[model samples]
Every structure is written in structure tokens, then in C-alpha cells.
Target: MFKFWYANQQNRVRWANSFSAEYRLECGVRQGGLSSPALFNLYMNNLIDELSRTGIGCHIDGVCINNISYADDMVLLSPSVRALRKLIDVCESYAATHGLKYNATKSELMVFKAGSKTYNTIPPVMLCGRPLNRVTNFKYLGHWVSDDLKDNADIERERRSLAVRCGMLAHRFTRCTTQVKVTLFKAYCQSFYTCSLWVNFTQRAYSGLRTQYNNTFRVLMGMPRFCSASGMFADADVDSFSTIMRKRSASMLRRFRDSPNTILGTLAERWDSPILGRWIRLHAVK
Candidate 1:
């Protein structure tokens, strides 16, 4: 762990007129630095500890998860609406004590199982003395998360976005060679698959993405949209989008297995039987 030393804390900048301005950055980590995330995690350690003591987060098989934090972004979890309110209260108190504040306008409430009768009667939640706006869908970590936990909406949105990006790429790289165009697509558009980690990808969604993938390659290679491109793909030695998704999913599963104590790991263990089903028994030696 990098120690937060006085010497390392010094930050200064020069803006206009050859003049220099210096100020003590007494809070938060440096933006865009390699070690910033680690430093921020260290800074948030105390807050996490405090929240853990509250016993207000989601509890599964005796393990409690009050919240998840990635750098400064946070998602507080609770089993009940009342408990969620308390959790937010604790969060607000912690922030106040730590010289931090919530962006109430940006903060929102999303009730899961929103169609349940219990949710209809639940009171509104407030943060920073203002009611949190209730939303049916919100984007988290660049993926749309809906109240129903369905991926179709998110997948359609991503498809449209990918189409728009491919259109722009086609317009800008009209003179570029096929190889160069493929390279650009790999660099810029591959993340569309990479970022879709938690989506429950339906067959329709997969087909749509695959269609887009094939069309993008076809456009780049100056081939008709209906033309077969198996030879082109073989020549480029690029994996299909489906293959990439499988590889990424397997990699993610391995990571989940490694994270034995995390919520994801716990869920993975709980669902192992259902996930593997009779396949595990079928593959096992007698």
C-alpha cells in the first residue's frame, strides 16, 4: 500500500501569466493517477467499516453487503425499503463526518420487484433533505439496469449505439484499407461486448449483435451486406462476436471463483447446481 505522506500530497499548477498557484489537497485522491483508485479505496476503508457495523445491508447466508464502492461511485443495498432508508441515513451521516456530500440531484431510488403491492405503498426516500427521484431504469457502469433486471432494453440501446458508431466509422474511414478498418473496429467497438458483463443475453440479442458485427465487417471490407464473409474472417483471424462473448464469460466466471468472499462469488456458489445442472453429473466419471 502507498502511504499518504506529506511530501507526496503536494500538488501545484501554473495557469496563465507564468504565475504558479499552490494549494493543499487535504482530501480525496489525485484524479487520473495510476494509484488514485487504490488511494481512494484506502480513504474509504473507514467509511466501509462504519457501514459494516450497521448491519443494514443485504444479508445472504449470514454474509452482509451494505454497499459496493468503485472509486467514489457507490451503490447501497438493503432488503427492505425501510432498511434502505436507514442505510441512506447512515451514508449521509458518514459523508457529513468525512467532509463529503451526496449529489442528491443525481442520486435516484429504484425499487426492485416494482410491481409488487408492497412497493406501491412504500413511502418516498429522501437524501440531503430532498426526495430522491424514483426511476424505473438507470445506467450503472455504462449498462442500463432496469427494475425488472431484464437485458432486452439495454441490448437494444447498445445495438443502436453500435450502429451509429459504425456509421460514423464508415464515413470517416472511406479511404482506409480493410485491415485498417478492422483494426479500428476492434479498438473502438469491441468494448460493446466487453462492457456487457451482467446482461442476460437472449438468443434474439445475440442474433442482433452478430448481425451488426457481420455487417460492420462487410462494410469495412467493401462487400455486399448479403455476401458470405467466412473467408474474410479466416483471413483476418478474428474471433466471432459469439466466441468473444463466451471467452469473456468464462474469464468472468474464473474471476468470480477467485473472489470467494465477495457477493458475486457467494451468488456463484449458491447457483452452481442450477448453473451446471445435470451436465456436471453427466461429465463426472463413474
Candidate 2:
């Protein structure tokens, strides 16, 4: 049945109103198909197994996590440059034998350290015989990951995004009903993207986001700048920024705890085991 579903697939290109002749697909799964992601995961299972057997990555409580992946995007983790290079080599060999290719240009190397020191002393990372770009920061899974592992840059970016969304909502929906405006605010302005991962941010940095959040409600309600917004949030049944972040972090922890994924669950439990841990310390349940 599976083979029948994927057999003899035909596709056509639509240019404006004109349609090109249909061509039968000789290889690969259908683009945007419902089963594509699952099929891709099955295809990559062997590669994941091989990498796991290499045992060259961050080790926690006897468990090794060499890579973090979501579909095609992957981040390789290792304690040292040499170990990371070995992981890359293994991946390259697997890809070469499997008729796959790596985009060396899109690949980047980032060295995480304790302090605000420069990474110039660290060795370069090579992929497929080409040097990958070394970056101080990179966006992964909708969040900014910095070399220093600080969340200030990511928080500031989220604040700017929220500010733009607030302005957009106000400009376009000023005449809408209060209830409608509130709905729009919740849909667009209320999202603190990846706030659950904000374990290393300054209070002042987050306070800025809270201020912007309050201003969003003020703009939506047409309240004066100096007017007290003390009970306004509660009155509108909207959670405060801090409360929202806390809830998101708690939700993330719950998902990790409930997930059946062995690798991810092990990693999360290891992090949560410590009293002053990452996911646990910030939103620890009493």
C-alpha cells in the first residue's frame, strides 16, 4: 500500500495561469506531502544509528548526544573541535555513500565557552573538505544561540518583533471592537517565541519586553501613557509577560517529561536532575 501510494507520481509546473505538461517523478517523495516528514525520518534512521555508535559528543550520565535534529536541519554537538570534526567526517562518509550532499556554505561552526572571550584560538571546522564559516551566533529552531550562551540578544530580537507586531495591530485595527483587538493581540502580539529557553537573560532585558507588552495593551485599549495599567491586564483576562514566560517554560518541561523519545528525554532529565538546573531552576514546581 505504501509503495502504491508513492508510485508513478506526476507533477506539473504552474506559471501564472498557464500549466506545463505533467512529468512523472522517477525519484524522491512528493513535495509537501503529508507522509514526507515521516518518510524522511525513516530514511535518516540508519545515519542516526551510525552517528550514535561513534560515541563522539556531549556525554551526560552515560548517555551521548551527538546531534540535535528536526527534519533536515541538524546541529552537531561535541566537547572538542577534533571530536566534532570526526562527527562531521562520519556524516560526510555516510552522505557520500548514500548519494547525498552537504551544503558547506550554509554550514557554520560556533564554539561555546564560559566567558566573553574570542574564538580566534579555536581550530577551524571543515565539512566535505571545505571550511565552514565560524560564527559568534546562529539561529537554531527559531532562537538565537550565542557563543557565550546568553539570551539577551535573542530577547532583544523578540522584543523588537513584538514591538513591530504591536504597531501593526494598532495601525490596522484601531477602529475594531475591543474584544476583536484583544483577539488580534493574543494571536499576533502575545507570542514570546522560544521564551522557554530564556534561562540566562538579565531581568532588565526581560523587563523591556514586559514594558512593551503592557504598551501593547494600552495601545489596544486607547489608554493614555500616564494612566495606570495596574489592573488592566487582569481586567482583560490576559496573562502578564512574566506569567506567560513561566507558563511556556513549564509547558516545555512537561512536554519533555511526557515525551517517549529516548535521546531527548535523557538529555532533559540530565539537565533537570540538578537543583540549579536550566529547565528546572527557572520554573521549578514547588
> For candidate 2, which ten residues in a row score worst on lDDT?
271-280
Give the runs in model 1 whose Cα sits over 4 Å from its true position: 1-27, 114-118, 193-205, 229-231, 272-286
User: Which digits, one per residue and each the tens of the lDDT, describe model 2 over residues 1-286?
Assistant: 7677668566898899999999977666778889988998998888888889999999877888899888889999998999998999889998999888899999999888857655577777888789888888999888999998889999999999988988888898899998998889888877788887777778799889889888988987798876666678788887777677677877887887799987657856664553227555556553
Looking at model 1, the pairs that clash are: none
**Highest TM-score against the true fold, candidate:** 2
Question: For all candidates, what are the clash counts?
Answer: 0, 0
Per residue, candidate 1 scores C-alpha lDDT tens digits across 205-268 of 7678778877887776687878765766777877666556555666666676788557777756
Candidate 2 Cα deviation (angstroms), residue 71: 0.7
Model 2 scores a TM of 0.89
Question: Which structure among the candidates has the greatest lDDT?
Answer: 2
Candidate 2 local distance difference test against the native: 0.83
